[model samples]
Target: MILDDFLIYNTNGLYCKCGDFYLDPQVPVTHAVISHAHADHAVASNNEVYCTEATAAFMQLRYAKNAAKVFNIAAYHQSFVVGGVAVTFISAGHMLGSAQVLMEYQGTKYLYTGDYKIQPDATCEPIEWAKADVLITESTFADPEVLHPDPVVEIKKLNDISLNIMLGAYSLGKSQRLINLITEHAPQKTILVHHRIMPINQVYERMGYKPGKYQIYGRKLMKQQGGFVYIVPPFTFDSYARAKDVKRLFASGWKNLQVNKQDTLFISDHADWNDILEAVKQVQPSQIWTLHGDGRHLKNHFNNDIFVKLLS
Candidate 1:
Protein backbone atom coordinates (compact mmCIF):
# COMPACT_ATOMS: atom_id res chain seq x y z
CA MET A 1 0.00 0.00 0.00
CA ILE A 2 1.30 3.49 -0.83
CA LEU A 3 0.06 4.95 2.44
CA ASP A 4 1.79 2.07 4.25
CA ASP A 5 1.11 2.44 8.01
CA PHE A 6 -0.67 5.77 7.72
CA LEU A 7 -4.08 4.31 6.88
CA ILE A 8 -4.92 2.67 10.16
CA TYR A 9 -7.73 2.85 12.72
CA ASN A 10 -6.95 4.74 15.91
CA THR A 11 -8.84 5.90 19.01
CA ASN A 12 -11.16 8.07 16.92
CA GLY A 13 -11.62 6.36 13.54
CA LEU A 14 -9.80 5.70 10.24
CA TYR A 15 -6.85 8.09 10.20
CA CYS A 16 -4.42 8.70 7.37
CA LYS A 17 -1.24 9.80 9.02
CA CYS A 18 0.52 10.98 5.87
CA GLY A 19 -2.52 13.00 4.79
CA ASP A 20 -3.23 14.30 8.29
CA PHE A 21 -6.90 13.47 7.88
CA TYR A 22 -9.48 11.06 9.27
CA LEU A 23 -12.17 9.03 7.48
CA ASP A 24 -15.48 9.14 9.32
CA PRO A 25 -13.84 9.92 12.64
CA GLN A 26 -16.10 9.27 15.59
CA VAL A 27 -15.11 12.56 17.24
CA PRO A 28 -14.10 15.98 16.02
CA VAL A 29 -10.83 16.05 14.05
CA THR A 30 -8.79 18.70 12.25
CA HIS A 31 -9.56 17.14 8.89
CA ALA A 32 -12.30 14.57 8.30
CA VAL A 33 -13.34 12.71 5.16
CA ILE A 34 -17.00 11.80 5.47
CA SER A 35 -18.43 8.92 3.41
CA HIS A 36 -22.05 9.86 3.94
CA ALA A 37 -24.45 12.01 5.93
CA HIS A 38 -25.52 9.29 8.35
CA ALA A 39 -25.29 10.43 11.99
CA ASP A 40 -22.79 7.74 13.04
CA HIS A 41 -20.46 8.48 10.12
CA ALA A 42 -20.79 12.26 9.84
CA VAL A 43 -20.48 14.37 12.99
CA ALA A 44 -21.11 18.10 13.34
CA SER A 45 -18.00 19.30 15.16
CA ASN A 46 -15.26 18.74 12.59
CA ASN A 47 -12.83 21.56 11.73
CA GLU A 48 -12.91 20.61 8.04
CA VAL A 49 -14.89 17.99 6.08
CA TYR A 50 -14.53 16.47 2.60
CA CYS A 51 -17.55 14.65 1.15
CA THR A 52 -19.92 14.37 -1.80
CA GLU A 53 -22.20 17.29 -2.65
CA ALA A 54 -25.34 15.62 -1.41
CA THR A 55 -23.56 14.50 1.77
CA ALA A 56 -22.63 18.09 2.46
CA ALA A 57 -26.23 19.14 1.92
CA PHE A 58 -27.49 16.40 4.20
CA MET A 59 -24.87 17.37 6.77
CA GLN A 60 -26.18 20.91 6.68
CA LEU A 61 -29.70 19.54 7.20
CA ARG A 62 -28.58 17.27 10.01
CA TYR A 63 -26.18 19.66 11.74
CA ALA A 64 -27.34 23.05 10.44
CA LYS A 65 -25.29 25.19 8.02
CA ASN A 66 -22.44 25.79 10.45
CA ALA A 67 -21.72 22.11 11.12
CA ALA A 68 -18.01 22.49 10.34
CA LYS A 69 -15.45 25.23 9.95
CA VAL A 70 -14.77 24.19 6.36
CA PHE A 71 -16.77 21.89 4.05
CA ASN A 72 -15.35 20.77 0.71
CA ILE A 73 -17.87 19.13 -1.61
CA ALA A 74 -16.73 16.81 -4.40
CA ALA A 75 -18.66 15.47 -7.34
CA TYR A 76 -18.94 11.72 -7.80
CA HIS A 77 -16.02 10.10 -9.73
CA GLN A 78 -14.10 13.35 -9.35
CA SER A 79 -10.59 12.95 -7.94
CA PHE A 80 -9.04 15.47 -5.57
CA VAL A 81 -5.54 15.28 -4.16
CA VAL A 82 -5.51 15.35 -0.38
CA GLY A 83 -2.09 15.63 1.22
CA GLY A 84 -0.41 13.75 -1.71
CA VAL A 85 -3.00 10.96 -1.72
CA ALA A 86 -5.34 10.91 -4.76
CA VAL A 87 -8.91 10.50 -3.55
CA THR A 88 -12.18 9.91 -5.41
CA PHE A 89 -15.79 9.43 -4.35
CA ILE A 90 -17.78 6.60 -5.92
CA SER A 91 -21.46 6.04 -5.40
CA ALA A 92 -22.17 3.54 -2.61
CA GLY A 93 -25.96 3.35 -3.23
CA HIS A 94 -26.47 3.27 0.51
CA MET A 95 -28.17 6.66 0.67
CA LEU A 96 -28.37 9.97 -1.09
CA GLY A 97 -24.84 10.83 -2.18
CA SER A 98 -23.26 8.12 0.03
CA ALA A 99 -19.85 7.24 -1.38
CA GLN A 100 -17.04 4.74 -1.11
CA VAL A 101 -13.76 6.52 -0.45
CA LEU A 102 -11.12 5.54 -3.00
CA MET A 103 -7.56 6.48 -2.20
CA GLU A 104 -4.55 5.94 -4.44
CA TYR A 105 -0.96 6.64 -3.53
CA GLN A 106 2.19 5.34 -5.17
CA GLY A 107 0.00 3.44 -7.66
CA THR A 108 -1.77 1.43 -4.93
CA LYS A 109 -5.53 1.75 -4.62
CA TYR A 110 -7.47 1.24 -1.37
CA LEU A 111 -11.26 1.27 -1.37
CA TYR A 112 -13.25 1.90 1.78
CA THR A 113 -16.82 0.65 1.42
CA GLY A 114 -18.67 2.76 3.94
CA ASP A 115 -22.12 1.24 4.41
CA TYR A 116 -22.94 0.35 0.77
CA LYS A 117 -25.71 -1.59 -0.90
CA ILE A 118 -26.12 -3.04 -4.40
CA GLN A 119 -29.88 -2.76 -4.39
CA PRO A 120 -31.15 -0.11 -6.79
CA ASP A 121 -33.27 2.78 -5.50
CA ALA A 122 -34.72 5.75 -7.29
CA THR A 123 -33.83 8.15 -4.50
CA CYS A 124 -30.02 7.80 -4.79
CA GLU A 125 -27.06 6.75 -6.89
CA PRO A 126 -26.42 3.08 -7.65
CA ILE A 127 -23.39 1.16 -6.39
CA GLU A 128 -20.30 1.24 -8.56
CA TRP A 129 -17.52 -1.39 -8.59
CA ALA A 130 -13.81 -0.66 -8.81
CA LYS A 131 -10.51 -2.52 -8.53
CA ALA A 132 -8.48 -2.05 -5.39
CA ASP A 133 -5.50 -3.59 -3.62
CA VAL A 134 -7.28 -3.61 -0.28
CA LEU A 135 -10.99 -3.49 0.61
CA ILE A 136 -12.15 -1.98 3.89
CA THR A 137 -15.80 -3.04 4.19
CA GLU A 138 -18.74 -3.10 6.54
CA SER A 139 -20.25 -6.43 7.70
CA THR A 140 -23.53 -5.26 9.12
CA PHE A 141 -25.43 -8.25 7.74
CA ALA A 142 -22.66 -10.78 7.18
CA ASP A 143 -24.13 -13.78 8.91
CA PRO A 144 -25.24 -16.68 6.67
CA GLU A 145 -28.59 -16.76 8.43
CA VAL A 146 -29.30 -13.20 7.33
CA LEU A 147 -30.83 -13.15 3.89
CA HIS A 148 -32.67 -9.98 2.95
CA PRO A 149 -35.89 -11.01 1.28
CA ASP A 150 -36.60 -9.35 -2.05
CA PRO A 151 -37.68 -5.76 -1.41
CA VAL A 152 -40.75 -6.14 -3.59
CA VAL A 153 -41.89 -9.05 -1.45
CA GLU A 154 -41.24 -7.16 1.77
CA ILE A 155 -42.93 -4.00 0.46
CA LYS A 156 -45.83 -6.15 -0.66
CA LYS A 157 -46.19 -7.42 2.88
CA LEU A 158 -46.29 -3.83 4.14
CA ASN A 159 -48.98 -3.02 1.63
CA ASP A 160 -51.08 -5.99 2.77
CA ILE A 161 -51.51 -4.84 6.35
CA SER A 162 -55.07 -3.76 7.14
CA LEU A 163 -54.58 -1.49 10.16
CA ASN A 164 -53.04 1.98 10.25
CA ILE A 165 -49.32 1.12 10.19
CA MET A 166 -46.61 2.83 12.16
CA LEU A 167 -43.39 2.22 10.20
CA GLY A 168 -40.26 3.13 12.11
CA ALA A 169 -36.86 3.79 10.49
CA TYR A 170 -33.73 5.87 10.63
CA SER A 171 -34.52 9.46 9.73
CA LEU A 172 -31.76 9.78 7.16
CA GLY A 173 -31.42 7.04 4.55
CA LYS A 174 -33.82 4.30 5.63
CA SER A 175 -36.91 6.49 5.83
CA GLN A 176 -36.37 7.91 2.34
CA ARG A 177 -35.93 4.44 0.88
CA LEU A 178 -39.11 3.25 2.58
CA ILE A 179 -41.01 6.25 1.22
CA ASN A 180 -39.97 5.26 -2.29
CA LEU A 181 -40.90 1.65 -1.64
CA ILE A 182 -44.25 2.66 -0.27
CA THR A 183 -44.85 4.89 -3.28
CA GLU A 184 -44.10 2.15 -5.79
CA HIS A 185 -45.75 -0.81 -4.11
CA ALA A 186 -48.62 0.66 -2.19
CA PRO A 187 -49.68 3.75 -4.07
CA GLN A 188 -53.21 3.56 -2.77
CA LYS A 189 -52.29 4.05 0.88
CA THR A 190 -51.50 7.51 2.20
CA ILE A 191 -47.85 8.14 3.26
CA LEU A 192 -47.02 10.39 6.18
CA VAL A 193 -43.56 11.14 7.56
CA HIS A 194 -42.45 12.41 10.96
CA HIS A 195 -41.16 15.97 11.31
CA ARG A 196 -37.71 14.43 11.78
CA ILE A 197 -37.79 12.83 8.34
CA MET A 198 -39.59 15.73 6.61
CA PRO A 199 -36.59 18.07 6.30
CA ILE A 200 -34.25 15.32 5.11
CA ASN A 201 -36.83 14.12 2.62
CA GLN A 202 -37.04 17.65 1.25
CA VAL A 203 -33.25 17.66 0.94
CA TYR A 204 -33.36 14.39 -0.99
CA GLU A 205 -36.00 15.78 -3.34
CA ARG A 206 -34.06 19.03 -3.78
CA MET A 207 -31.05 16.90 -4.70
CA GLY A 208 -33.20 15.62 -7.60
CA TYR A 209 -34.35 12.35 -6.02
CA LYS A 210 -38.10 12.12 -6.36
CA PRO A 211 -39.47 9.42 -4.04
CA GLY A 212 -43.10 10.15 -5.01
CA LYS A 213 -45.79 11.58 -2.71
CA TYR A 214 -45.68 11.85 1.07
CA GLN A 215 -46.97 14.21 3.78
CA ILE A 216 -45.69 15.38 7.15
CA TYR A 217 -46.97 13.59 10.24
CA GLY A 218 -49.47 15.45 12.42
CA ARG A 219 -51.44 14.61 15.51
CA LYS A 220 -54.59 15.09 13.45
CA LEU A 221 -53.45 12.33 11.05
CA MET A 222 -53.14 9.92 13.97
CA LYS A 223 -56.89 10.25 14.46
CA GLN A 224 -57.57 9.16 10.89
CA GLN A 225 -59.30 5.86 10.25
CA GLY A 226 -58.43 3.06 7.76
CA GLY A 227 -55.15 1.74 6.30
CA PHE A 228 -52.78 4.71 6.21
CA VAL A 229 -48.98 4.45 6.56
CA TYR A 230 -47.08 6.71 8.95
CA ILE A 231 -43.29 6.53 8.59
CA VAL A 232 -41.20 7.97 11.39
CA PRO A 233 -37.89 7.51 13.14
CA PRO A 234 -37.93 4.88 15.92
CA PHE A 235 -38.21 7.40 18.73
CA THR A 236 -41.09 9.17 17.02
CA PHE A 237 -42.99 5.90 17.13
CA ASP A 238 -42.38 5.69 20.89
CA SER A 239 -44.01 9.10 21.37
CA TYR A 240 -47.24 7.73 19.93
CA ALA A 241 -47.34 4.29 21.57
CA ARG A 242 -50.86 4.75 22.83
CA ALA A 243 -52.50 5.32 19.42
CA LYS A 244 -55.35 2.86 19.33
CA ASP A 245 -55.48 1.85 15.65
CA VAL A 246 -51.70 1.79 15.04
CA LYS A 247 -49.85 -1.44 14.25
CA ARG A 248 -46.10 -0.97 14.58
CA LEU A 249 -43.62 -2.15 11.96
CA PHE A 250 -39.98 -1.44 12.59
CA ALA A 251 -37.86 -1.18 9.45
CA SER A 252 -34.25 -2.21 9.89
CA GLY A 253 -31.86 -5.11 9.40
CA TRP A 254 -32.00 -5.77 13.16
CA LYS A 255 -34.90 -5.97 15.57
CA ASN A 256 -35.83 -3.16 17.94
CA LEU A 257 -35.25 -4.18 21.57
CA GLN A 258 -37.63 -1.56 22.96
CA VAL A 259 -40.54 -2.34 20.66
CA ASN A 260 -40.72 -6.08 21.19
CA LYS A 261 -44.25 -6.75 19.98
CA GLN A 262 -43.85 -4.68 16.81
CA ASP A 263 -43.32 -6.45 13.49
CA THR A 264 -39.94 -6.22 11.74
CA LEU A 265 -40.11 -5.02 8.12
CA PHE A 266 -36.64 -6.49 7.19
CA ILE A 267 -35.65 -3.43 5.18
CA SER A 268 -31.89 -3.04 5.06
CA ASP A 269 -29.91 -0.28 3.39
CA HIS A 270 -26.68 -2.28 3.87
CA ALA A 271 -25.57 -5.35 2.01
CA ASP A 272 -26.70 -8.69 3.41
CA TRP A 273 -24.53 -11.87 3.68
CA ASN A 274 -24.99 -12.80 0.02
CA ASP A 275 -24.33 -9.25 -1.14
CA ILE A 276 -21.14 -9.07 0.92
CA LEU A 277 -19.92 -12.34 -0.63
CA GLU A 278 -20.72 -10.96 -4.06
CA ALA A 279 -18.76 -7.80 -3.23
CA VAL A 280 -15.73 -9.89 -2.29
CA LYS A 281 -15.81 -11.77 -5.59
CA GLN A 282 -16.30 -8.59 -7.63
CA VAL A 283 -13.83 -6.25 -5.92
CA GLN A 284 -11.11 -8.94 -6.04
CA PRO A 285 -9.05 -7.14 -3.42
CA SER A 286 -5.80 -8.80 -2.44
CA GLN A 287 -6.46 -8.21 1.28
CA ILE A 288 -9.76 -7.70 3.10
CA TRP A 289 -10.26 -5.74 6.31
CA THR A 290 -13.68 -6.04 7.91
CA LEU A 291 -14.98 -3.32 10.18
CA HIS A 292 -18.41 -2.34 11.54
CA GLY A 293 -20.85 -4.76 13.13
CA ASP A 294 -19.27 -8.00 14.50
CA GLY A 295 -16.80 -8.24 11.52
CA ARG A 296 -16.59 -12.01 12.03
CA HIS A 297 -18.71 -13.57 9.29
CA LEU A 298 -16.76 -12.26 6.31
CA LYS A 299 -13.42 -12.94 7.98
CA ASN A 300 -14.40 -16.51 8.84
CA HIS A 301 -16.05 -17.25 5.52
CA PHE A 302 -13.20 -15.98 3.35
CA ASN A 303 -10.07 -16.63 5.44
CA ASN A 304 -8.99 -19.77 3.57
CA ASP A 305 -10.01 -18.41 0.17
CA ILE A 306 -8.53 -14.97 0.53
CA PHE A 307 -6.52 -12.79 2.90
CA VAL A 308 -9.07 -11.55 5.50
CA LYS A 309 -8.90 -9.96 8.92
CA LEU A 310 -11.33 -8.34 11.33
CA LEU A 311 -10.10 -4.82 11.89
CA SER A 312 -12.61 -3.91 14.59
Candidate 2:
Protein backbone atom coordinates (compact mmCIF):
# COMPACT_ATOMS: atom_id res chain seq x y z
CA MET A 1 0.00 0.00 0.00
CA ILE A 2 1.13 3.58 -0.69
CA LEU A 3 1.37 5.17 2.76
CA ASP A 4 1.91 8.65 1.35
CA ASP A 5 -1.68 8.64 0.17
CA PHE A 6 -2.79 8.91 3.80
CA LEU A 7 0.27 10.45 5.52
CA ILE A 8 1.84 13.61 4.11
CA TYR A 9 3.85 16.70 4.98
CA ASN A 10 2.26 20.10 4.92
CA THR A 11 3.47 23.47 6.19
CA ASN A 12 2.21 22.45 9.62
CA GLY A 13 3.83 18.96 9.82
CA LEU A 14 3.04 15.41 8.96
CA TYR A 15 -0.72 15.22 8.57
CA CYS A 16 -2.55 11.88 8.78
CA LYS A 17 -5.58 12.02 6.55
CA CYS A 18 -6.98 8.75 7.81
CA GLY A 19 -6.73 9.80 11.44
CA ASP A 20 -7.72 13.44 10.82
CA PHE A 21 -4.80 14.78 12.85
CA TYR A 22 -1.32 16.24 12.54
CA LEU A 23 1.81 14.54 13.85
CA ASP A 24 3.96 17.09 15.68
CA PRO A 25 2.50 20.01 13.83
CA GLN A 26 4.89 22.92 13.29
CA VAL A 27 2.18 25.44 14.13
CA PRO A 28 -1.12 25.63 15.98
CA VAL A 29 -3.43 22.86 14.84
CA THR A 30 -6.91 21.59 15.54
CA HIS A 31 -5.98 17.96 16.23
CA ALA A 32 -2.31 17.51 17.04
CA VAL A 33 -0.80 14.12 17.85
CA ILE A 34 2.38 15.23 19.55
CA SER A 35 5.32 12.82 19.60
CA HIS A 36 7.17 14.76 22.26
CA ALA A 37 7.41 18.05 24.13
CA HIS A 38 10.35 19.58 22.30
CA ALA A 39 9.57 23.15 21.18
CA ASP A 40 9.86 22.15 17.53
CA HIS A 41 7.56 19.12 17.90
CA ALA A 42 4.98 20.25 20.42
CA VAL A 43 3.28 23.64 20.40
CA ALA A 44 0.95 25.39 22.85
CA SER A 45 -1.85 26.44 20.52
CA ASN A 46 -3.20 23.07 19.52
CA ASN A 47 -6.90 22.63 20.21
CA GLU A 48 -6.66 18.89 20.88
CA VAL A 49 -3.37 17.21 21.81
CA TYR A 50 -2.78 13.49 22.06
CA CYS A 51 0.41 12.28 23.77
CA THR A 52 1.82 10.49 26.80
CA GLU A 53 1.13 11.66 30.36
CA ALA A 54 4.75 12.78 30.76
CA THR A 55 4.56 14.77 27.56
CA ALA A 56 1.36 16.42 28.75
CA ALA A 57 3.09 17.35 32.00
CA PHE A 58 6.07 18.81 30.18
CA MET A 59 3.77 20.76 27.87
CA GLN A 60 1.90 22.12 30.86
CA LEU A 61 5.20 23.10 32.47
CA ARG A 62 6.48 24.80 29.35
CA TYR A 63 3.21 26.33 28.10
CA ALA A 64 1.09 26.80 31.22
CA LYS A 65 -2.22 28.49 30.41
CA ASN A 66 -1.43 28.67 26.74
CA ALA A 67 -1.12 24.89 26.38
CA ALA A 68 -3.57 22.76 24.45
CA LYS A 69 -7.22 23.09 25.28
CA VAL A 70 -7.71 19.33 25.45
CA PHE A 71 -5.19 16.59 26.19
CA ASN A 72 -5.83 12.94 25.18
CA ILE A 73 -3.01 11.24 27.04
CA ALA A 74 -1.99 7.64 26.23
CA ALA A 75 0.65 5.38 27.67
CA TYR A 76 3.33 3.48 25.81
CA HIS A 77 1.91 0.60 23.71
CA GLN A 78 -1.61 1.76 24.47
CA SER A 79 -3.97 1.84 21.54
CA PHE A 80 -6.87 4.21 20.86
CA VAL A 81 -9.00 5.19 17.93
CA VAL A 82 -8.82 8.58 16.28
CA GLY A 83 -11.16 9.50 13.46
CA GLY A 84 -11.86 5.79 12.92
CA VAL A 85 -8.17 4.84 12.56
CA ALA A 86 -6.38 2.91 15.27
CA VAL A 87 -3.47 4.80 16.89
CA THR A 88 -0.89 3.61 19.38
CA PHE A 89 1.92 5.34 21.26
CA ILE A 90 5.30 3.60 21.36
CA SER A 91 8.35 4.73 23.28
CA ALA A 92 10.88 6.49 21.03
CA GLY A 93 13.59 6.71 23.72
CA HIS A 94 14.25 10.32 22.85
CA MET A 95 13.30 11.94 26.14
CA LEU A 96 11.04 11.60 29.17
CA GLY A 97 7.85 11.21 27.13
CA SER A 98 8.90 10.88 23.53
CA ALA A 99 6.87 8.44 21.41
CA GLN A 100 6.51 6.92 17.98
CA VAL A 101 2.94 7.33 16.68
CA LEU A 102 1.62 4.17 15.07
CA MET A 103 -1.48 4.59 12.91
CA GLU A 104 -3.35 1.61 11.54
CA TYR A 105 -5.91 1.82 8.76
CA GLN A 106 -7.29 -0.91 6.54
CA GLY A 107 -4.92 -3.42 8.18
CA THR A 108 -1.79 -1.44 7.19
CA LYS A 109 0.27 0.04 10.00
CA TYR A 110 2.30 3.23 9.54
CA LEU A 111 4.86 4.11 12.17
CA TYR A 112 6.00 7.70 12.60
CA THR A 113 9.16 7.77 14.68
CA GLY A 114 9.94 11.05 16.33
CA ASP A 115 13.52 11.84 17.26
CA TYR A 116 14.75 8.62 18.88
CA LYS A 117 17.84 6.91 20.26
CA ILE A 118 18.80 3.25 20.71
CA GLN A 119 21.67 3.88 23.14
CA PRO A 120 21.01 2.85 26.71
CA ASP A 121 20.42 5.80 29.04
CA ALA A 122 19.11 5.51 32.56
CA THR A 123 17.46 8.94 32.40
CA CYS A 124 14.60 8.12 29.94
CA GLU A 125 12.68 5.15 28.56
CA PRO A 126 14.52 2.83 26.17
CA ILE A 127 13.48 2.62 22.51
CA GLU A 128 10.75 0.08 21.73
CA TRP A 129 10.06 -1.25 18.24
CA ALA A 130 6.70 -2.17 16.67
CA LYS A 131 6.02 -3.97 13.44
CA ALA A 132 4.57 -1.77 10.71
CA ASP A 133 4.02 -1.84 6.97
CA VAL A 134 5.36 1.71 6.52
CA LEU A 135 8.02 3.29 8.71
CA ILE A 136 8.35 7.08 8.92
CA THR A 137 11.68 7.81 10.61
CA GLU A 138 13.84 10.81 11.30
CA SER A 139 17.09 11.09 9.37
CA THR A 140 18.89 13.61 11.54
CA PHE A 141 22.02 11.42 11.64
CA ALA A 142 21.34 8.91 8.89
CA ASP A 143 24.68 9.11 7.14
CA PRO A 144 26.82 5.98 7.53
CA GLU A 145 29.77 7.98 8.88
CA VAL A 146 27.77 9.53 11.72
CA LEU A 147 28.33 6.98 14.49
CA HIS A 148 27.96 8.38 17.99
CA PRO A 149 30.64 7.43 20.50
CA ASP A 150 29.79 5.95 23.88
CA PRO A 151 28.41 8.79 26.02
CA VAL A 152 30.09 7.44 29.16
CA VAL A 153 33.46 7.75 27.47
CA GLU A 154 32.52 11.23 26.27
CA ILE A 155 31.41 12.33 29.77
CA LYS A 156 34.50 10.80 31.36
CA LYS A 157 36.54 13.40 29.50
CA LEU A 158 35.38 15.91 32.10
CA ASN A 159 37.40 14.15 34.80
CA ASP A 160 40.64 14.71 32.88
CA ILE A 161 40.16 18.48 32.90
CA SER A 162 40.94 20.26 36.16
CA LEU A 163 39.44 23.65 35.24
CA ASN A 164 35.86 24.82 35.69
CA ILE A 165 33.74 23.73 32.70
CA MET A 166 30.89 25.60 31.00
CA LEU A 167 28.92 22.82 29.29
CA GLY A 168 26.18 23.65 26.82
CA ALA A 169 23.22 21.34 26.22
CA TYR A 170 19.53 21.41 25.40
CA SER A 171 17.65 22.11 28.60
CA LEU A 172 14.95 19.46 28.29
CA GLY A 173 16.55 16.07 27.47
CA LYS A 174 20.27 16.65 27.11
CA SER A 175 20.73 18.54 30.34
CA GLN A 176 19.24 15.76 32.47
CA ARG A 177 21.17 13.08 30.55
CA LEU A 178 24.43 14.97 31.04
CA ILE A 179 23.81 15.24 34.77
CA ASN A 180 23.36 11.47 35.01
CA LEU A 181 26.42 10.82 32.86
CA ILE A 182 28.65 13.21 34.77
CA THR A 183 27.59 11.94 38.17
CA GLU A 184 28.09 8.32 37.10
CA HIS A 185 31.31 8.82 35.14
CA ALA A 186 33.04 11.92 36.48
CA PRO A 187 32.61 11.65 40.22
CA GLN A 188 35.28 14.28 40.84
CA LYS A 189 33.37 17.12 39.16
CA THR A 190 30.36 18.78 40.77
CA ILE A 191 27.28 19.53 38.62
CA LEU A 192 25.64 22.95 38.46
CA VAL A 193 22.51 23.58 36.40
CA HIS A 194 21.15 26.78 34.97
CA HIS A 195 17.91 28.20 36.42
CA ARG A 196 16.01 27.67 33.15
CA ILE A 197 16.72 23.95 33.28
CA MET A 198 15.45 23.41 36.82
CA PRO A 199 11.74 22.99 36.04
CA ILE A 200 12.43 20.36 33.42
CA ASN A 201 14.68 18.53 35.83
CA GLN A 202 11.92 18.60 38.41
CA VAL A 203 9.56 17.04 35.88
CA TYR A 204 12.07 14.24 35.37
CA GLU A 205 12.33 13.73 39.12
CA ARG A 206 8.53 13.56 39.46
CA MET A 207 8.52 10.80 36.85
CA GLY A 208 10.61 8.68 39.26
CA TYR A 209 14.09 8.98 37.70
CA LYS A 210 16.86 10.75 39.59
CA PRO A 211 18.90 12.85 37.14
CA GLY A 212 21.80 12.94 39.62
CA LYS A 213 22.63 15.51 42.28
CA TYR A 214 23.12 19.06 41.07
CA GLN A 215 22.87 22.55 42.54
CA ILE A 216 21.32 25.62 40.97
CA TYR A 217 23.68 27.81 38.98
CA GLY A 218 25.26 30.89 40.55
CA ARG A 219 27.95 33.22 39.25
CA LYS A 220 29.80 32.81 42.52
CA LEU A 221 29.81 29.03 42.16
CA MET A 222 31.44 29.13 38.73
CA LYS A 223 33.97 31.73 39.89
CA GLN A 224 34.72 30.08 43.24
CA GLN A 225 36.34 26.85 42.00
CA GLY A 226 37.88 25.02 39.04
CA GLY A 227 36.23 21.62 39.63
CA PHE A 228 32.61 22.55 38.87
CA VAL A 229 30.72 21.46 35.76
CA TYR A 230 28.29 24.34 35.20
CA ILE A 231 25.62 23.18 32.75
CA VAL A 232 23.75 25.93 30.90
CA PRO A 233 21.46 26.31 27.92
CA PRO A 234 22.94 27.19 24.52
CA PHE A 235 22.40 30.96 24.67
CA THR A 236 23.98 31.24 28.09
CA PHE A 237 26.88 29.01 27.10
CA ASP A 238 27.50 31.09 23.93
CA SER A 239 27.38 34.32 25.93
CA TYR A 240 30.33 33.17 28.05
CA ALA A 241 32.46 32.43 25.00
CA ARG A 242 34.81 35.32 25.76
CA ALA A 243 34.89 34.79 29.53
CA LYS A 244 38.04 33.30 30.96
CA ASP A 245 38.89 30.84 33.78
CA VAL A 246 36.82 27.93 32.41
CA LYS A 247 36.85 25.51 29.52
CA ARG A 248 33.83 25.71 27.17
CA LEU A 249 32.37 22.47 25.83
CA PHE A 250 29.08 21.57 24.16
CA ALA A 251 27.74 18.02 24.49
CA SER A 252 26.24 17.02 21.16
CA GLY A 253 26.61 14.58 18.29
CA TRP A 254 26.67 17.25 15.61
CA LYS A 255 30.24 18.38 14.89
CA ASN A 256 29.08 21.88 13.99
CA LEU A 257 27.61 22.48 17.47
CA GLN A 258 30.76 21.19 19.21
CA VAL A 259 32.84 24.30 18.47
CA ASN A 260 35.25 25.09 21.27
CA LYS A 261 38.93 25.15 22.14
CA GLN A 262 38.44 21.94 24.11
CA ASP A 263 37.75 18.56 22.62
CA THR A 264 34.17 17.74 21.55
CA LEU A 265 31.79 15.58 23.56
CA PHE A 266 29.88 13.55 21.02
CA ILE A 267 26.81 12.88 23.15
CA SER A 268 23.42 12.81 21.43
CA ASP A 269 19.90 11.71 22.32
CA HIS A 270 18.99 11.02 18.71
CA ALA A 271 19.67 7.79 16.87
CA ASP A 272 22.82 7.67 14.73
CA TRP A 273 23.37 5.81 11.44
CA ASN A 274 23.76 2.35 12.94
CA ASP A 275 20.88 2.84 15.32
CA ILE A 276 18.59 3.96 12.50
CA LEU A 277 19.58 0.90 10.48
CA GLU A 278 18.85 -1.27 13.48
CA ALA A 279 15.45 0.34 13.82
CA VAL A 280 14.77 -0.34 10.17
CA LYS A 281 15.70 -3.97 10.67
CA GLN A 282 13.45 -4.23 13.69
CA VAL A 283 10.48 -2.51 12.07
CA GLN A 284 10.80 -4.56 8.88
CA PRO A 285 8.72 -2.08 6.94
CA SER A 286 7.81 -2.50 3.32
CA GLN A 287 8.42 1.22 2.75
CA ILE A 288 10.50 3.84 4.60
CA TRP A 289 9.55 7.50 4.89
CA THR A 290 12.17 9.96 6.17
CA LEU A 291 11.80 13.41 7.67
CA HIS A 292 13.42 16.02 10.01
CA GLY A 293 16.68 15.86 7.97
CA ASP A 294 18.25 14.70 4.72
CA GLY A 295 16.86 11.35 3.56
CA ARG A 296 19.24 10.80 0.66
CA HIS A 297 21.42 8.48 2.69
CA LEU A 298 18.59 6.11 3.62
CA LYS A 299 17.12 6.34 0.16
CA ASN A 300 20.46 5.53 -1.43
CA HIS A 301 21.28 2.78 1.02
CA PHE A 302 17.97 1.02 0.52
CA ASN A 303 18.16 1.53 -3.29
CA ASN A 304 16.19 -1.49 -4.49
CA ASP A 305 15.52 -3.48 -1.36
CA ILE A 306 12.77 -1.28 0.05
CA PHE A 307 10.98 1.87 -1.00
CA VAL A 308 12.45 4.95 0.76
CA LYS A 309 10.45 8.14 0.46
CA LEU A 310 11.62 11.59 1.56
CA LEU A 311 8.79 13.58 3.17
CA SER A 312 10.85 16.68 3.87
Pick the TM-score winner. 2
lDDT per residue, candidate 1, 1-312, as tens digits? 434464788998889876788999999999999999888999888999999989898888777866898999999889998888889999999998999999888888888899999888888999998888888889887789988877767787766678888887888888888888989998888898888788888888888897778998777876777568988787877787786777877777775432545455777889998898888788899888888877777777776877776777
Q: Each candidate's TM vs. the true structure?
A: 0.94, 0.98
Global lDDT of each model? Answer: 0.84, 0.91
lDDT of 2 at 53: 94
Kindly report which residue pairs in candidate 2 clash with one another. Answer: none
Q: Report the lDDT tens digits of candidate 2 across residue range 1-312.
A: 555678877888778888889999989999999999999999897999999999999999999988899999999988999898899999999998899999999889999999999998888998899999999999999999999999988898898888899999999999999999999899888899999999999999999978998999888888886889999999998897897888889999889888774588999999899999999999999999999899999999999999998888
Per-residue error (Å), model 2, residue 66: 0.7
Lowest-scoring 10 consecutive residues by lDDT in candidate 1?
Answer: 255-264
Off by over 4 Å in 1: 1-4, 257-262
Instruction: List candidate 2 stretches off by more than 4 Å.
Output: none
lDDT of 2: 0.91
**Minimal lDDT window, size 10, model 2:** 1-10
